[model samples]
Target: MALIFLYIHVLCLWLCSSTYNAQNVFFQPSFLVTRGPSVTALLYGNSSNIILILQTTSPSNVTGSFDPPSCVPEETRWVLTSELIAKTTVQVKLRLNRSLRLCGNNETDTDCCVNPLCVRETLQVSACEGNNSQASLIVQVKVYARLVSGNMVFDNKTIIQNQVYRPLGECPCDLTFKTCDLWCCCDEDCSTEDFQLFKYHCLPGPFGGQFPDPEYQCSVQSSQNSPDWFPFLCVISPPGNNPYLGLFYQGNKIAPKPGMSFGASVSSPPTLLDAYIEGSPILTLKDQYFTIPRTLNGYCVTSAPVAFLKNFDVKCVTPLQACPTEPPLQTIPEDLRAVVKNGVGGNAVVDVTDQLATELNDFITSSESFGSSAVVCENVPLALDYNFYWKENGISGITLTRTLGTVTLNGNVSLTTRYSAKFLSGDITSKPNSGNPGYQVGRPVIGGILNTSIGNDSLLIERSPMHLWKPVNCGLCSHADVRPVLFGENSTSGCLLPVSQLNLTQCGLLRDTVNSLQDGLVEASLVAINGHPNAVTMADWLNISYVTLNSSGVGDSNSSCSNIPAHLQIYVWTLVTGFVDEIPQKDIKAVEISYSLSSWKLECGGGDPVCIDPAETQRLPVTSSVTFIDIPLNTGPPKNRYQINFTEYDCNRNDICWPELAFPFTRFYTGEPYSQALAKGIILVFFFIVASVLGTPWRQIRQIWSTI
Candidate 1:
């Protein structure tokens, strides 16, 4: 029993030893594949004394192909078949052996595997084929793997350590494929030598079949730093508003509306209008108005009521030819003589001669007979005078003494005739020599004649019953009322109306006649002339026809006062004689004479009542004066008085005839004393006293001489 028991024990020990070896060989973790030193092991073992063998799965023997092959000897051996390990799971550890052989049949040769480089790898291995090690557990080893470090083979495919590899085929991680520095892609084919790596965001799968999401695909070349690809539109939204759409060419934003037309030479890129179709039915190039689409936004056509771009033009013209001209003056006709009969009133016959006559004839023939005619009288050298005359007839058998003046006519048959010149004396019978007498005398005066009968015939004279031409202090008969009468010869018979009716013509005939009647007087008194020294009464000098009228007395006798009528007549006669003797010198046809009369009141009384008794009555004495003078008919009166008379003398005997008369008296004072006797004595005594005084001086000298 003892021997048998000992045999069982020996047998049990051998069986248990074999069981331990088998478990350690098949299931022991041996090689480590780690990224760092012992931090994470790809394979871990519980035994410390296990041997590690590393190999590379890569076929290349380059330095970076895989890990270097290494052997780690231990007290115990950890065994693994090559079939159970992947070549990609092996790692190799290698060492530099300058004197050793790395691939040869000699194991102890000096230059074999001495470089201390090892590889470990985890790889995928193929099954062992026909003549390979099949008995005795012949394992096939693969040094290259997909992932490896040194010469170790890992059962798992995880890389336990960081390792370098020689990239094979077309490795994307190769340095030859690296894009760095300033290198750029120029082609769209990313697989070609000139292809560039592109970065693209995953977008909706539409254009180029790209994916959308977090994954990015490499397709076309990136537009960044590219010359051909440009940012066609860039719109930057405002803070709160829509983004601005920016269109760019060659990286610059193109203007939306360009001023200049396209296709024209420009220095910059085209505008936005050239690059885009903006809003709704965008304007296209096919429209009828789109002849020049390049100028689209440049000039847009608005709606109706279209405004033109600018302005238009204008023009003008003119004409050609010319015009015409005109003419001159003339002369006036000369004058000729023209005589018109009864052309004007009075002796106012106008003689039109020369130019005046021609004008007058033209005027007369063109005008009516009664209407006015321009009878032009030129250079009429003859002096024209209008003369007036009247006749006087009052006393019976009285003859008038008249002086006839000589007359001559230069043209036509003119004659001189003497009308009867009469004295317009007041009375000389009452006081034969009175100094002044109030009397107005006229000849052949019709309206103012005195009615009387001589023998069996009746006579009418231009005398009043009082023998005064007008009353004393008669306002109407004053100088204002006197006017001259004028006469003219009959054309055929050369006969004139009587001087009383000489004023019967159109030129104031009625006016002159009325004036003469109201203001004229006729004188018919006989003047008595005496040849005696003593004073004579009117009764003493009787029935005288003529007297020697003298202005002063002769031989120491004082001159006696003459009657006014007789003295005026004598003065007129003297003038007539002188005029007749000087007839050749006289040029006028007649002469005009004017006369006047005035009177004043007188009272004769003293203040003694008894010496000149109240019962004794005294008579008042009144005196008057008349004067006659000759003046040119045209000369008007210088001063006017109470009464006046006018008379005209006709030098032509061809009209109106009257007999010559001597001086005649017209008025006399009826009751008045003849104080000439007392007056003469007083005048003689006054002259004697004056003579004695003058002679006294001379006589005294003579007396003294005699006494001596």
Candidate 2:
């Protein structure tokens, strides 16, 4: 067997635990850039008293712009931040209801009635430092149109391979020549320039103009291949481990040593998240440590506005350094903390409870096929089953408390790992089966009775029946497309990819939520797997030495864990209050308390249920929520080092490694016409056969037949 050295970290929750960008934002309703403010709140604009209500208009046709809050009052205020460089141009934040809105009282006056902010001009506004010159505070109301690439969405923060940030060329709205080049929608009057990909970069536009491009670099972490019993690496540490008593793998169910613990929740996660997006952040992300329910000791995490609430608060500090490993953890911005404590205003907990549950069910139910080559448990395919819920924390300090359930570890496991008994030397087989599956290699997984208490939410999954599709008549291809189809030269079908729009992640899984069927996953199928278990064939063909394989295969196994990964990897997502010792290396790390970036809360007149009205009534207080997408990243990027000159991304520089996404979709190859090609082949074969038969003289044939 191959000697393999593993450096896997075992998280102890109590002992351990476990634990971007905006681009083409407008066409995408939930683009990250559109979700949060790029700059921190400039509490004091250049001019404070000269309160100028930026009467900006947000509409569907606007490109490079964020979608405005729905049904909001016609006006919204803008802010300038000290964090940003001096003199930044500001854009309008309001989406205009052209037909319903009345900008002013003059119905007949076109200028007063129509939406004021123009899309053509840059939204960038100069500082309003209450300057003597009116020019300092001058704001432009330009008309713009949408010139978008529905398929070509770009992200500035997340860099992806082959997804280089190409410079976007603007149509150059030539006001001088109303008759310009690119097709576009202009103001009621053709006074502004046409809108094209412009200079609003998430990173410094190395290529010039702003590259509001979006990309993700999915570092293909190690992945087990052709797993025999499904893989599980216990963080013998806290948050990462789920308590399980016995592992039912390949016929053998191995129990953990007495007193030793194992098995984690194959369901809900321990940590939860809540983020506030869509404008300048009222809440800033910071480092924080909170106590776990079981122990007085707590784990520290860099918060996403609210990974921990006041419920877990201890002594607090400021400007958290590094990832939390110290004591007396600091807190996130205080104002944001207050909001979460209050919960009566805009959404406090961006809850994604339902989504996480759905994700959990999907992962738990999903399975991988078994193969003999996979001798080690790490060699098998594994799925993470983590579920969580967010609602009232049961405590008044927090508006909503995120109660996490168990985190499930599931995958397809073989019944009994088989090998050619011929090669089994009495010496190797001399050792007991160890009563463990994949024991020939290192013992990858063990189960034990957990000491912790089990609640109603605890999920105990035993064994699931393994069903492999076989051909009954014509071939397995004749079977329904219900199960994942394999791909190959003889393959009848694989996953079929549907046409899809560009996603915020850019290169990672392109899941189409509205129509789950057409997701990019449907475009490919797991036709074949790579990696070999280094087996040597000897002169005695029957006897082969099974050498262990080193390093994990190249695949998206880690990423598939994300509920997303890469720019923001989800090392561990929990639904319950679990423990984690260390965090993987990534920019944004998060744990949820009572929120999901996807959570929605309606704020009309505070949390007053009475302010709500009938949908039909104008007086019906607007059901409002900052339209947000709970991406793996829920909070805004850190403000400390925003740049004038953007740095190139790892993917752009080809400096990072990426995992291969198991063929998630079906594919079709279009080539030579079958009928015509077959006819040609037949003709060639027919001529050759005829020539051969004729080549033999009749007399020689007769003689040969007689001899026979």
Candidate 3:
């Protein structure tokens, strides 16, 4: 490239002066970026140099005359004309000096500039500098396309475009402007590699920045007002309700598990989590906290705070691609969700998980009461303990959902409590201070609300803080409505939706979804305790009072002014399908399985998550996705097929779903093997028909249906 430049510089300098008979230097038809259909310009130059600027404004053509330097004062007249050949390509023509003939404009043109009489000059277009979209705005005429020319010098072996001619233009709404050029940056592209915002892509433009946020504007254009189209579909929803991103399970807020931690992982050994976290469980809620791991529609928010207050407030992450946002949030793997069952695992974070262990102790004591000798969950803490006595067998599940597409996973974890802590029942007030009853209940904090004012679709989830309880105070939270609004937190007169008690509902749901594995916790803990087989029926279960979204009530100091939106009427129910494995042989662990039907976000990391453009309520009659998740913890993904279903307001579409069954019933020829069999059968039938018509094989007609 450097050598090319050297050659160009030498050739161009030689062409300008070598005693040319025509005394002419004209750039060949060059590719120029013209804002409008036409361009005109004037020229002035001496024998030593020539200054010419091509432009588009009013009159048809631009003509001018300049004298020769170090020679005659009376000069040559040059005409410049321009035309737009393509959207961004242009052709400029220069007509000059017919009288000052280089070789007298005849065959005997020996007085050429460099070597031979024939010279082909060419100029290449470099790049776009700038253009104007508004006529009223007085902006400096900027340089749009640059022109670089090189001569096909007779003796020079290489032709290099070394000379650069850049013309600065003033662009307005159209060609009527005094100087400005009119152009549009509708190329359907912007390099987000540097930043999501592109200056030419209407970012901080002359018009007020139409982009609410870089993630919104730069993402797939989803609104009418949001530039007609964009490079990709975007899913920057408001912070979703807690970790599941406001997704509910089996028609109720999933009871937060006592000590389960959740995160995302894609690598093998599966132990290396992408973004894992655990939080305090509100009171005794079984699965209320963010326990089950599943791919969120957008990006992952830090489990640090569960929800967001407003759009203006800074967010650590968004719902979709977790880019272009402030204070980086953990990048939760969107492909697989990992729930370390024993309790949120001991992976980096400690404060939240420790508190949950205490709360779990409180819950077990309340349930067992210690009156009878059979103490079930009395001494168990979800954390790592030498005497915890937790064991994990092999577990696995396959998710048939939109986001993950289709993922299958299998693993085993074991957690056992080594020590038992004694506690008195009904001593809540004695243990903690007054005014706040369950305030000390290890509860996960939910931040950021979900907004769905725009782009509400069947497969697209638009989460907003507005959906949550709004705070009484904007700046500081004096009172805020936190997630898991418990059974009696909302008054009949104050908040619209009253908290619904789901204690029995929680245990029952678990029983229905997790009992397929004969060796899992449900069996070991009840049906077969300590190698003793005992039939524990549903009748033996106790009616437990688990907190819903109304967790921790509201902070005592902030209780008086709880953010009503965060604390009030927002609700979501989901159907999750996955597998659970419990292996206590070597290590103690709990396996969790879950899956979603539709994408919570428009884009699911891939180019498109849908076969057809998702309609608000329009239903796709027959498109199926088979998701596969590969997880090898040294332990392979379980062979059993499992799934779960949950739903709420699914765009009023038919909530039709296929139940997640627990068997490899489809392990046969349902796929390619079936297709091959089908083809062979068709060929056989065709041959039989031909044979029958031709006069043979009639004996085998009825026998084919029976057997060989």
Candidate 4:
């Protein structure tokens, strides 16, 4: 017999979870200039009123003939802050949907517009502060566009990489015109000779533009072989060296000028589209657009926007510097606006309930606050729920609410915000069904225990118990949050339970509690048919795992309780059917449950009679998971079926013969029938016999036969 020993160790460390660029921001302008003046502007404040200051040096000659600068709105004034020898400073306050007025008395409109203010404006020092001392000092203000001529620009903002767009080249590596550049094979001026000499050593363009060669491989090993290999020559190899580089050329072959805006012209709020795109922002009823806050790759984004007819629930952790006084809809300007004015009458106003404000205030102030020394005061959002009623035309009404946790001073708050959006029909205002005839993908799965002990024919279904698993004191598991198992989603949740003094009495109580939590699912008698609980039949259940507990005796000094239930895993198998123009229907087919058990034992040390730290309590982790597996619906049977017998070849005379039936030779059989194969074999044999007999001499053939 052989003996084996195993050792296991566990370590847990609580660290302050922090991430970079958690908020979703559009157009992170990071300007880089090689040989030109550059200006940097920082915006500070909320969305209603944002202040931006620009300071740059002005050239003395201001009378250069150039395109006219864009006009600035009346509400936004560019005030001259300071005027020095050749430098000037100006400030402007920007607001959303502000009106604009005509500036000059000329009948021809130069800068004024019937629409909103232009994003690009050129303010003169004289016009801003009536200081005409420097005529050439015109301040060019460009928003969401490049402000300087540069070869490269790097922005660390969260950009949706899934968008389909043509890249406008800002850097041209081919500096020389009509001339061959050394090691620049992409240069159009380079001839075949120049290309051949520099092809192996071609350098990548600054903005990742390369020659359009679809078959080119940038790998070192691939370059070291034939076709790409240059014998006995060192070649430079860079990753992703392919023809389809990041370069996107314009049809006109003209490079965009500096300070050119690539984004769409924003004159007013965008109109509603037939269907909203995923990750694209929701339409703004007024000046504010609704953003679904979420975290991507561990960083929080304020605008993982909602897609029309697509339901979602996103939960993420974001760090807040201070506790918020107002609701998230008001504090975070990205939320959908609640109040709007009636366009008919200027004074007529449409009122909305302050549900978010009231809910958030109660959530924050109602929670228990801790002292500075006892509790760490880092703030994170608790939850933000959005319910929108939309019709065929557009969104009809919206209801928003927010919940915040404890707030502390000078403490970093780690909060988790769960944001969910469900769009209901404007006419149908009742609780939305999981599905019309089948279960929806994101909706909660319906499951419960059916009780028939009440009467002979009476049956009652009890809702499944849910364990609270909220984050407490920055811990991974807690006992405050409530969540459900959503359909088509596989998720695991657990809570920590502290057990003190694992004795027979305590173990018995734990056993009873776990059994109650199991809810007799292990011995379920029936199953729902097509996700319809009322329509059920005798279930053909398969037991994945059975819960069991074994103990030697009550208060047995040498024995301990083993096989206590510690985990429960639920497996739901659903049959998914496709529809031509409707949402996919998911119907429940089967369900399986598995239970895992744990044991309680103490370790003795130093030859002590009792266990070490026997009085200390242990935090045992209890977890449960629900996994959904989609089974493709069987679409009838095949048009033709193969034979059951392996030995018999039963293919039709017109059809191709079975390849495996060529038994003696286990090779692929040609499409030809056996008769044609035999005829070809006989003809080849006859020709070979004739050739051998005519080509070979009799004496040589006899000698070959004798040797064989």
lDDT of each: 0.25, 0.25, 0.25, 0.46
lDDT of 4 by residue, 413-527 (tens): 4455677777676533333445656777776655445666677665555434222233343232333244655777788766665554544236666666655554432334333
Superior by TM-score: candidate 1 or candidate 4 = 4
Candidate 2, residues 599-640, lDDT tens digits: the string is 112234555542343221111010111111122543445534
Q: How accurate is candidate 4 locally (lDDT)?
A: 0.46
Report the C-alpha lDDT of model 3 over 335-441, residue by residue, as the tens digit.
21333223223311111112223122211112222333431222222221111111132111112111111111112112211211111212222211111211111
Instruction: Please list the residue runs of candidate 2 whose C-alpha ends up more than 4 Å from where it truly belongs after superposition.
Output: 1-135, 141-143, 148-708
Task: For each of the candidates, give the backbone clash count.
Answer: 112, 114, 119, 8
Candidate 1 deviation (Cα RMSD): 69.3
Candidate 3 C-alpha RMSD relative to the actual structure: 35.7
TM-scores, one per candidate: 0.12, 0.14, 0.13, 0.37
Winner by lDDT between candidate 4 and candidate 2: 4
Q: What is the lDDT of residue 173 in candidate 3?
A: 20
TM-score of model 4 vs. true structure? 0.37
